[model samples]
Structure formats: structure tokens, C-alpha cells
Target: MAGGFRRSGQQRQPKLQGKGTLEKMEREGPFKEWLGMPDLYRHTLVIDGDTYTYQVEDAELPFAPGDKVVFRYKEVKSGKWIDRNSLGTWIDPSTYNQ
Candidate 1:
């Protein structure tokens, strides 16, 4: 048979659970084994002072390494910390934080 799709029950879908909620952090998180956390929850970013996490799909197009980014931390109703929408801009790293 040519390339075919797996049955509905044969697929393993990932749950998009961010890391802003954790026992070691906020509360005891899901009992996820390894690789359970989505890519969005992988980064533990601490800028200025507060903690922050990235969004999954949005992260695919985000700040790159060595790029000086200007962003603001926004608190969601769920108590999660995230970057303010439309607030991130790329600045010259040479003059950043100076």
C-alpha cells in the first residue's frame, strides 16, 4: 500500500501544557514523563527579575539568539506570565541594556 494514515487511535497527540505551573514552581504539575512538556514550555526564561515562558506556536517565529529584544511581561488571568502581544522588537544588541 502507498503511504497511508494511521488509525485515529494510533496517533499520540501532544498536550500543550505550559511550565508556568509546577510544584517546584507554582504547584505540583502534571505527572508527565519525559518529553511530555510541549516545546513552548521548554524554556525557563528569567528576564530583568520575574520568570516567563514562551508560547508554543508563536515561539516558532520569535526572538533569535544574539538579538536584543524589547518586550513586556504581561500577566494572564490564569496567573501565567507571557510577553505582551505586539511588544517585542529587535534592537541593536551592542547598545542593549546600556
Candidate 2:
């Protein structure tokens, strides 16, 4: 592997959900070293005064600015969280059980 670490299908942590108004969304790059590599999409969303950023292969988001949304995420660090869904995972409005 590139960094002396074997790559595996590892889930970092259990997914948690949050709700907030969509303050912003920005997408950047299809950055890759080679032509055959997949495009990388960086998604940044500002929600409830906090910034949430992540990158993935897809460019789909469930909410837009000014929209109140319930979404899923997983904490990657002490206070850093990433959307559980590549884009923004949508939660049913009727369910806020978690």
C-alpha cells in the first residue's frame, strides 16, 4: 500500500445523525493522478454554525441553503464529523428518534 497501511473496507465509527439549516455547499476537484482514476468530489456544508466537509465519488446532496435537513454523519475525530452518506444522507422528517 502507499502509506505502509493495507486498505480495507473499514467503517470509521458508528453513524450519527444531525439536523440543521443548510448554510452552504461547495464542490471542488476531480483531482486524480491518472486518467483512469475515478473523479473525486469534495463536498462542504455549513450546518448549525458548524462546518462539515467530506469527499466522495458522487455529487449529490439532499438539501440546499436555507433548507432545514436531517442528515447522517460519523465522527472521524474528537469533534470532526463527515456525512455518513457520500453526499448528504436524508432522514425521514417524521423520524428523529436518534
Give all candidates' CA lDDT scores.
Answer: 0.41, 0.68
Structural similarity to truth (TM-score) of each candidate: 0.31, 0.57
**lDDT by residue for model 1 (38-97), tens:** 433334454434455544323343544334344444566654355535335455568888
Please identify model 1 stretches exceeding 4 Å from their true place.
1-50, 75-80, 92-98
Evaluate model 1: give its TM-score.
0.31
Q: What is the lDDT of residue 48 in candidate 2?
A: 80
| Model 1 worst lDDT window (10 residues) | 19-28
Candidate 1 clashing pairs, residues 3+ apart or interchain: 22-27, 23-27, 23-28
**Candidate that would win on TM-score:** 2
RMSD of 2: 7.4
lDDT tens readout by residue for model 2, 1-98: 45444468454445676777778888877667478888877777788888887667767655679887666677656554566454444566588785
Candidate 1: global Cα-lDDT? Answer: 0.41
